[model samples]
Target: MPKQLFHHFNKYLELTEEHFQEILPFFEIRILKKKEVLMEAGNMCTHNHFVLEGCLHMFFLNDKGTERTVQFAIENWWITDDLAYLNQTTTDFSIQAVENTRLLTITHDKQGQLLKEFPQLEKYFRTIYQISYGAALVKMRYLFGLTKEEIYFHFTEQFPLFAQRVPQYLIASFLGLTPEYVSEIRAKKRS
Candidate 1:
């Protein structure tokens, strides 16, 4: 684990050096190449990945054979199939490295033990999950209430880095639109 990991933990909870030393062993660092699949659909997602560098996308194939992106995680963000990871069930989606990625991961078992051993970590994770939940709610509201163009512009305005880093096709899928529609929106913006 890196000092930055401790720093990230500290943002949500006050932890001492001893706490860092104790929890460090629970997390393992992994590096992934671009296009690498971290977890495939139907397999148990055993760990929650915290991105240290690069990007990852979580997606699933729809009934119509379209790839629908559910989430994207970049540096300092956590990405996982939360339902699968927490419940220890098979995942309904897949996670892939959108670019060369560096991650720190902790297994569910280790996380449970870590919280038992260090109670403060429970608060830390709760805060993180709460934030994630709140964001999910906002995104859901946007998806239901906004038009395709409004959703596109809202996403671009809120996550400019995502627009810059993720492929347009994936972004379009995430926005519930086609690549050609996204291109048209971009052209209209430039004019």
Candidate 2:
């Protein structure tokens, strides 16, 4: 678990063995069953989870009570409500395991201490957050502006494994399309 975490961090910033060892204690490994909710709406998101295996989905209900998926985290990715975690405030989002999962989670206080102990990690996390934010911006534009077919194709092109790993309804929700519409599109493509 620590090895996987080390590999993830090393991609963004180089860390000395001593520094890595020092920060290792701050992370706690968690195993979650499929459909298990890690964080719920109206609760503070106290920890950021690093996926070692399986998938996680972050979503919230819209006014019509439909699930609107904001993000998905697979292996080697991080998942959390950034604003809630940072501000220690309640979140409108819920995070859950899409499959049985292995995670390394860091609490807000531990994250601060770990960063203080190894400043290089700050660069790694900042880069990760920037990328996440940029992706969110692009996704927002696509959701509102793109045609449903185009959005589906673009999503599959970018994250091909998502169609296999996630339920069709959830994928449809994320693309702002109805599940029946997604099925129709798939049928049309097959024909």
Candidate 3:
């Protein structure tokens, strides 16, 4: 079991090292190259990935065939097409590596089994879901409440790691701005 995972679980619920060991086998470790596709749109979403390092983006192609990033998961964060993964249905979003990444992946069936075998883990998952949902809500608020430049600045302010680590194009996609606009903003910031 990764000490990082153990520490993450402890953030929500206390689990003995022994007990955590028991649940550890339910997950698989995955290493992805930058731009690797983990899940594609129109495929059944079977796995939920937890980031151990690096980053992942959940995005969809727009009507014009431009990629629109909806969410990103960095180290210690979780990424999945939530509804599709839960319902075992096809996903509208595709998940991809933003950089060379390491992740812990659990299939939907294995997750269910893990929960049944370790019911206390339900609290941990539930807490994660709640936090994810709240973050989504906040993202929506930012989308509506902030200007494009403002949104970019606020997001960079809140997550400087993303600004430094993720490509500016992906950041622009996430903020619903054109890459050129993001370049303009960055140029202005320097000047």
- Sort by TM-score, best first: 3, 1, 2
Q: Write the per-residue lDDT of candidate 1 for residues 1-191, one digit (tens) a residue.
A: 37878899999888898879888899999999999999999898899999999999999999998999999999889999998898899999999999999999999999889889998788888888999999999999999999999999999999999999999999998888999999999999999
Q: Can you write out model 3's per-residue Cα lDDT over 6-100, one digit (the tens) per residue?
A: 99999999999999889889999999999999999999999999899889999999999999999999989999999999999999999999999
What range of 10 consecutive residues in model 2 has the weakest lDDT sum? Answer: 15-24
lDDT of each structure? Answer: 0.92, 0.91, 0.94
In candidate 1, list every pair of residues with a backbone clash.
none
RMSD value for candidate 2: 1.1
TM-score of each: 0.97, 0.96, 0.97
- Runs off by more than 4 Å, candidate 3: none
Per-residue lDDT of model 2, residues 1-63, tens digit only: 668888888888887777778888998999999999999999988999999999999999999
Pick the winner on TM-score between candidates 2 and 3: 3
Q: Which ten contiguous residues of candidate 3 have the minimum total lDDT?
A: 1-10
Candidate 2 regions exceeding 4 Å error are none
Please report, as a residue range, the 10-residue window in candidate 1 with the lowest summed lDDT.
1-10
RMSD, every candidate, angstroms: 1.1, 1.1, 0.9
